[model samples]
Target: MIDKAKLSALAHAVIDTEIEAVKALHERINDDFMQACEFMLHCQGRVVVIGMGKSGHIGSKLAATLASTGTPAFFVHPGEASHGDLGMITDKDVVLALSNSGETSEILTILPLIKRLGIPFIAMTGRPESTLATCATAHIDVSVANEACPLGLAPTSSTTAALVMGDALAVALLETRGFTVEDFARSHPGGLLGRRLLLRVSDIMHTGDAIPTIDEEALISQALIEMSNKGLGMTAVVDDQYHILGVFTDGDLRRVLSQEINIHTEKLSAFMTRECKTGRADMLAAEALELMQRYKINALLIENEHQQLCGAINMHDLLRAGVV
Candidate 1:
């Protein structure tokens, strides 16, 4: 039977070793690392990453990170490169090749061709003086003292070291290019961050005849009827020209009841809350959420540059739009 406790202990040991490996990576970021960043930044074309096996897997992830963070990059398999994918690499582009031992056969097989093309190449390797490092325009040392594997053969600590080094390279280049979160969002427009940054109020607002509204001179009973009909829990009190004068909410109705005001005989303008929060139709939906949070309000009226009631958005609408 398997010794579950021993297996758990071994797994913990491996995690500790990998953690130490990443911790030791700070010392390796020297002049060569800076040179790698500088070379990539100056390249006029995209970053083409190539590797084999486990290194290729890591390279794919690094390529994705680079592309999402503002660097145009993609991964090409080393074996595929030999079979005509090398055409994807251009003299203007930079090639980032990963090989822990610096002698991955599949990667090294095409070195002569890269040299012939005169494309700038960077190598990540455990050995400083390996063939791959020697051929690179800039070499990043991802040397691990030992493997986390008990047999010292599996790619463990070494792979972690290489991955962290790749992240360092991407982030260094990201700062050099001044990559912003908005730029990052453009690359990941399908996630929550994309929705928060890209979604605007006009895209998800109740406008036109659907907006629940009543004139300031309207009776409270009529405003309540409008709120009930629209199901927005509130109604905007506007003037004849549709300028928002105030807002009446279910909470206001409760407060009026507590004050013993005759709900059937009151005007909405007399009891409505003045200085209601408003947003622009073109503003980001995320900004509307922030305004709602800051003012502790549940609903907001949308206005134009002239402060006319163009539309309205409530917390539920924001929730439906993924703004929450």
Candidate 2:
């Protein structure tokens, strides 16, 4: 049986080693890092990320992060590149190659073709003196003093350092390009974050026949009928020009009932909320949701510059639109 005490000690050592590896990277982010970002930012073509073995797995994720964050990039396996995949590389593109030892034979084989294409290259390696580093325009040193593996054969601490460096590069490029949340949403439209940022009130608001509405002079009973028919628990009261004058909600009905106001004798204008919170048709559904939460209210009348009621939305609309 294995000794549990030894196993736990080894685990702690691995965590301690990786922590130091990442800490060392903080000091290495200087001129070369900026130069690498400048190279990719100025590239007219896609950034090609190439790596061998385990590094290739990390490289693929790095490429994806860069592409999704506004930098046009994709991963190219170095072995595949040596066998005609090199055609994908162009003079306008920038190559980001990864090799912890800076001596992966498969990656080295494609160095000549990358050079022949005249594409700029950034090298991420442990050894700055290695051939790959010597050929690169910018070298990002991702060296760890030692592998976390007891046998020193597994790629543990080294891989972690490389992945962190890749993240740093992607974030730096994202900031330098002034990439906004909207830009990120454009890339991730099918995801939840994208839906929250891209879906606007206009897309989910109920308009025309679907909107519960009544004239200002309408009786409270008539407004209640409109609210029940539309199933929004509220009705917007409009003026002669269809401009919003007030809003009548279930909450208001409850208040009126407590006061024993004669529902049959009153007009909606007498009981409706006159300074009701409203939203613009073009506002983001997420923003509308925030307003609703802040005001402790749900329904909102959508209006234009003329204050004309164009539509209406509620907390339900935000949920349905995936903005909640």
Which number leads on lDDT?
A: 2
For candidate 2, the 10 contiguous residues with the lowest summed lDDT are 315-324
In candidate 1, stretches whose alpha carbon ends up further than 4 angstroms from where it belongs are 1-9, 256-266
The residue-by-residue lDDT of candidate 1 on 1-324, one tens digit each, is 999999999999999999988988899899888888887888899989998888999999999999999888999999999999989988899899999999999988999998888888899898989999998988998988879999999999998998999998899889889999898878888789998999999999999988998888788889889999998889998888999988999999888889998778888888899889899999999999999999999998999999899999999999987779
- TM-scores, all candidates, are 0.89, 0.88
> What TM-score does structure 2 among the candidates reach?
0.88
In candidate 2, stretches whose alpha carbon ends up further than 4 angstroms from where it belongs are: 1-4, 190-196, 256-266
The CA lDDT of each predicted structure is: 0.90, 0.92
* Model 1 residue pairs with clashes: none
Write one digit per residue (lDDT tens) for candidate 2, span 82-117: 889999999999999999989999989989888888
* Candidate 2 positional error at 88, Å: 2.5
